[model samples]
Target: MVNLTVTQLLRDRALADPEGVALIVQGSAPLTYGRWDERSTELANGLVERGVTRGDRVGLVFGNGDWADYAVAFFGVLKAGAAAVPLSDALAPADLRFMLGHCGAAGVVHAEGLEVAADGWTVTPGVLRAEASAQTSYDGRSAGDAVTDPPRPDDLAQILYTSGTTGRPKGVAATHANLAYGCGGKRRPFAHSRHLVHAFPIGTNAGQTMLINALDAHPAVVTLPRFTPGRFAALIESYRAGTVFLVPAMAIELLNAGIAGRHDLSSVLLLGSAAAPLPAPVAAALTGAFPNATITNYYTSTEAAPAQTIMMFDPERPGSVGRAVAGGRVRIATPQGEPLPQGETGEVWMRSPAAPRSYYGDPGSGTFRDGWIRMGDLGYLDPDGYLYLVDRESDVVKSGAHKVSTIHVEEAVFGHPDVVEAAAFGVPHPVMGTVVAVAMVVREPVTAEELRLFLTGRLAPHEMPAQVVTVGELPRNAGGKVDKRALRSSLTAPADLAPAHE
Candidate 1:
């Protein structure tokens, strides 16, 4: 079993192939494995000199640049026996404050150009870079000065905050073992075969997982400083990358950018889509674009990744989320915790060794039952043991006595020939309690009456949207999922609303 900490993971890679390219960022210089490890060692020494101690929390706020520096910072913190807290740079200042305060971070390490204002103390990237390069004097002791008090499998390695789409964000405390289980423990029929092209921000769980798995398996990872369809295509062609991981929105943008036809991307072997469901049309477009690649979509959350089912497309199981990986079990249960049979829609619950042990600083219990974690998602498992997601439990629209899945309505609307994107939500209704409302972006003019009629035969009476709002674009989060709360607020204006039968 692989019991080493993330710090060790880097050290091992450094020892095995010091000259191999460990990180590459567009518009920046590449960092070799040996240089990456040595820099991390120096950063560790710097942190030690700066009073960073074991079990201390170090907050990191940065974008996807040559993050090998931050990796060194992370290892330095870990080697000093401290936990790392990486925050997405996309978050607003207020949100960043909430996360930093919530995590009780001792200090922060921010990027050179980002706007991060913290009260106590903050370390700039310049300082770490100078220290790593031995151009600046550091008072902290080196890793060799003190015996390594590395973290155990159960020790907390990092605390990641949730996206807070539904409610207040909760901190997910991931132990070294928890992350390792996600990286390697879950059973799969296939070994690591694809070179991953990661475009997500490194602070997020998706990025961290990609980093660990790539280093553990020594996959050639092509990094993009920022996600641009053109740049992504260029990297894939330049590196002859075999696999890629992208959110649905990025995939759609790539399709719109016409990068597939412009580049020689036939070397792509597997295309993995996660963070959100890939619309059927988008998935189809990708399949046509990358004909040689297999499309695999996984359903998971930040709290417990690789949790639930992974749907690898098969002709027989069109929308199935494949089967549960080893060391994990999935159950569909009612709100009352009653188990539902196959084909019955219910909340999806997952139990796995990789699941989060507990929410950081959350006193309330019941997040986990036995070993199962409530996924907060609505879905059903088919008779063939394939999982299908409908929508989030919080996003389900309650109209009078009926419950409607917004994703279903959105999917139907998006299927329209002229519609580019769509979102469905519940609006406060006087008589019905709540009514289904839809917001849409279209490529051409389409009347509300036309859309209502288009969906008449496609959706049930209760599922039919009472109003359709036309917009140029839908509000989205950093992960590219629809920001329904923002969409709800936008509908409050008079000009934005249109009658369904208009």
Candidate 2:
């Protein structure tokens, strides 16, 4: 059967390979397709019995240790004809309440020991058993009718909230067709590997993608309860994991901790970095760390899933995020929505081959138009059609008359051997509107002036940082992205710094 919906993927997989291992969490038992299907169905029956009807929204709050249960809850909501709003346990109580309320959720399915207060009914996975008595007092229809009438491809499958770095978080709703578009092929994804590993937390697009891969791909998914340099290395060595995925932050930690020499990572054939850009220095260092692996970087946003640029670490085009693959298209557009000439810097827009997703209530949002998604990034296309990012739209530093790319400045600063991590942003200046400032984490002793001198050869005079401060670490948002908004609040450039150039 061709799987057009998420529930069908599990149903078909369970029927074909009932005992095949689907998911494994470190320090926990493996879950087979048969058990996964049975447990999720049980939960779906429970949800239906509790008055969750078609098109209803259900919240799923889970921690990393609860990946197995989380997977069950995600599919169960679909089976009951409701959209699952998966949230991380790391979120604050107020944030959780705000999201659930914004969605007008009918109920929330939480992991055991996690406190969730929703206006609608709330139940934990433990009490969803057939034998366990119902927790909610709602007088609802029988479970049989709702579960039998499963959701269609156009029905809402999931709602993922943005990180809200710019403003309040917005919910991006995706229908079943949007998620299950390219997932119907006979050959499962990543077929060369027997096991795939990732540490993406719950409520993230990457984590949800992994869940779909576990359902549709050939390899059994493996993950850790928490991501640490040592434990992650041990898991790779222990499982001889062939496919490993991580963000740039984790990549930096692995390189800095020197875990490659301590553990035998020769089994890693494909090491993928996503959710953030991979700096050129970090990508170069990763090659030596995983000698047998092909380092790949993926670029996409929450609204543009299954439609990303995949760059396979080309030495010649180190900064290019690669052309759009998988039938997707990428183009540079002006602020007025006109396409720009090649090699011209402008707003980046990408169109997905799959059905597009939009803000839950605001389908008319300017972010999406005519099947194209504005990537919220500023970049240009090379002559060969590869995309090279200049900077984020919000991260561009505008000086007196010149606009500087923070990514360009950070990349130049990262070239320093002693520098571990760097973040560049705009700081207020009296003469110029805003001047460039940078914060860095370094290993060895290096003064601001010395680092600025090194950047002199790489960066233009106007693009250089006016102020440089050393820090032990950079501030990261809940989604693991650098918080430039927070940086702007706390850091200020020195008055005695060099003046901005015309």
Candidate 3:
């Protein structure tokens, strides 16, 4: 394995193909490989001049169009021996403030129009105005020469904040080796392919990893400022992209947008989905749409890279998430910490070298036990070694002394002919303590009685929803995971919807 830092990869690429296009955004001018190197070097020099130093944290708060500059900024920070903190663009102002403050960022780089209220120095595109001076030769030293004192592989390279769906966001400390291992391990096959299109927010770990992999492979990357089904199809057609990364919601949207016959997507070789579970129906739709493509689903978290198993596209195993990748192992244990028998449901635990060293600034210790990180997900490994996800442990609904897996109910409800999407949650019930209530987006008007009848054959009597509410849409988190907490808050008294009686 060629153990090279991300900065070294960029410098190597710049040296190999300076004139080749490195980045292309929808509205912005394309940046050539040479231009990217020069700009990053200039920004690194600028940051050094502006009081940034080794071990300092530099926060980045920008959208996709700024990825090129952000990449430069990120490498610049790394080159200066500082850590880069990339904040999500979708974060609320208060959450953003908490994260920036928690990370104790020395400075932040934002786009021109975003109004961030961090108590630190802010750098924007305006800093690039020093055209004549920005071109200075990286303080008169090349990147290769400045690497005499390169950072150790275990040194913190970046701090990525968790999605905070459960509570306050926590910073995940990632090392250069952790990232390089994750990026480099997946580098070869992707790089050898001719075409790959990435359509994720630039600040996300998925996005950063994809960027590094794309650059390392030197594949054609089609960037999108934000995901749109129409635009995605056009890019694939234009570039004849062979591989694509999509969140589950984006996959559904593509199907709803009728992408199968609208474009000649026959050239696509692989389709990967992550960030959330792709319902079996949607996965089937994708298989039908891209007959030649190998569809794969991955189970992972921001704190751990390639932490768990990956289920590659196989028609026989429809919903299985696959077995562990190289250097990773998984265990299924009960709530009381007892190991479950194979084919029994339990919480999923994973061990991988790519897992975070620790949560940043957290006083608590011993999160890892004998190299395994508890993933807090509910699932089981089949007797055949295939991994299956039941649902998020927190998402399980407790009603009338019975625990119901919301994913199971939602899957059954979504299997209904008229339903497009289904979200299940616990609603207040006077007698049952809490009752299973469901909200759905549908293609046709289906009465609550009809839905209950449809679910009768699919779910247990107690597991079926007590009341069904129709909604046009379900709220989602930044990564496009359905925000069940938000759905629970939107509920009115269950008396409004006609209650289903046994």
Candidate 4:
């Protein structure tokens, strides 16, 4: 019932614990709550003075390791009554320009030496101080605090861009209420110590979730600016972090690198992964990696967030994504969007009381319908209402005139002891129209025939891969989900990336 906003989440935290550690970035000084609040406030005032008004859009152009400035730009825009459009640091000039124009931002804020190709006024964190200093020429008290207005719960706080698997990325408009879920207006008691850890890329849904968790779930957040298997393990051990979140991709790397065994990772109490289904083997490996932590997998999307199905790892039901939690509801629906019987696979739809957001430019497009999001995934609810993901509707291959779930084959492939990761899709075959194809990464040398033999009885006859390929690694999008679209598009390229034959 607390009507607190995202800005209030930070303000309340600072007032309650001004000296509390807020952010911990490797090779940088830790930031305190009081400093974060004051710095963001100053930046908010600066943007306001530069004519960035309420309801305006402001772009955040920051790269990895620019956490401090990114935080300032993010909250400053929200506190200034403008929506923060967080652009990916990996964006090229063309992509950056499109988003800036797409969001129709009033201006862009970035750090010095951070290269970005864009138009309109460019504001930096230093500009806030510079403007405050320049005010001394008129009256010398100090522009002390920028008197910017706070946003309401309904106001758009952030416009996070989706991974654009289907087409160009669309801006997901998130209101204050959407971002402020689960904060409870105060920090959680430090169960093990005072820190939580994650290597989530900034500007991502997972990254933003960690940022919000740092505000109220724990006193400090330890971040891995650039993720590497060794670095990820070292940070958790170095900080004695109690809770951690990783996408399945990162978890696989950690297991492959075997750093968890080398590091003292027993301090972890909560181990969560999202953005993709964790294969049975990866889930089992993670339990061994963070032995003391509770392993959890969450199901959510950019279109339907804050509302998700959260499943604590249950070995008996290895593939389940878990039941809905945190005031969220999930249902399997027919193509017409009507609810289907339990255990029937169809489009997965999510409903949340957190006041759902919409696409910025195309409001209420087919995806958002009557308090529900299409989720773009095909899944089923167990007789017990436990949800299980199958595959993206678009990624489900029609092979040999029968629909085949890539996940079905991938799951069987992952069950193999030596397979590290696997991706299955339908490739054009003049005879079958489309035939099942698989690409994989393995722990040791394994031939395609060996894998095909292993999958013989595990999958349906039609679901069996017509061809097998071995790759160095699976390509991932910004959200850490496997880029199946990119993989499908490049299947025609040279044999270097994927070695497969009809």
- Candidate 4 has an lDDT of 0.81
lDDT of 1 by residue, 1-502 (tens): 4574666666767887898776667666767778767766666666666777777788888777747656666666676677888887778889889988988888887777666777647887568556555534434543333224566777778888877877777888877777666343333212444356768776676777666654565565668778889999888888777778888878877887789889988878788888888777777778877878888887777765646567776756655666687667788997767799888999988877563556888846566666678888899988777788888888898887888999888878988898878889987765676778898888899888899889988998888888788998788876667889988876654443333221
The global C-alpha lDDT for each of the candidates, from Candidate 1 onward, is: 0.74, 0.88, 0.75, 0.81
lDDT, model 2: 0.88
lDDT of 2 by residue, 1-502 (tens): 3338988878889999999999999999999998888788778878877878899999999999999999988888898899999999998889999999999999999999988888988888778855223433223544322354777888899999998878889999999988997885888889888999998888988888889988988899999999999999999888888999998999999999999989999999999998888998899999999999999999999998878999999999999898899889999998767999999999999998888999998878999989999989999999888999999998889898898999989889999999999999998888887888888999997887898789877998889888888888898865678888888777774664666666
What's model 4's lDDT at 458? 92
lDDT of 4 by residue, 1-502 (tens): 4466889888887898889888878878887888888788777777777888889999998766877678767887887899999876877678788888998988888877776666788867787657744663222223545566578888889999888767898999999988886666333645566788888887688888877776777548888679999998999898888888899999989999998779999989888898888777788888888889889898888789888888888988998999888788899998778999888889999987687989998984999899988998899988898998888898888865588888888989988888988898767665566667788898898787787788778987778777777889888777788887777776743332222222
For 322-382, candidate 3 gives per-residue lDDT tens digits of 8888778787886545678998889887777553456889836444555566676899887
Clashing pairs in 4: none
Which rank order by TM-score, best down to worst? 2, 4, 3, 1
Runs in model 1 deviating more than 4 A are: 129-148, 182-194, 336-338, 493-502
Candidates in order, TM-scores: namely 0.91, 0.96, 0.92, 0.94
**Highest TM-score against the true fold, candidate:** 2
Give the runs in model 4 whose Cα sits over 4 Å from its true position: 133-144, 186-193, 493-502
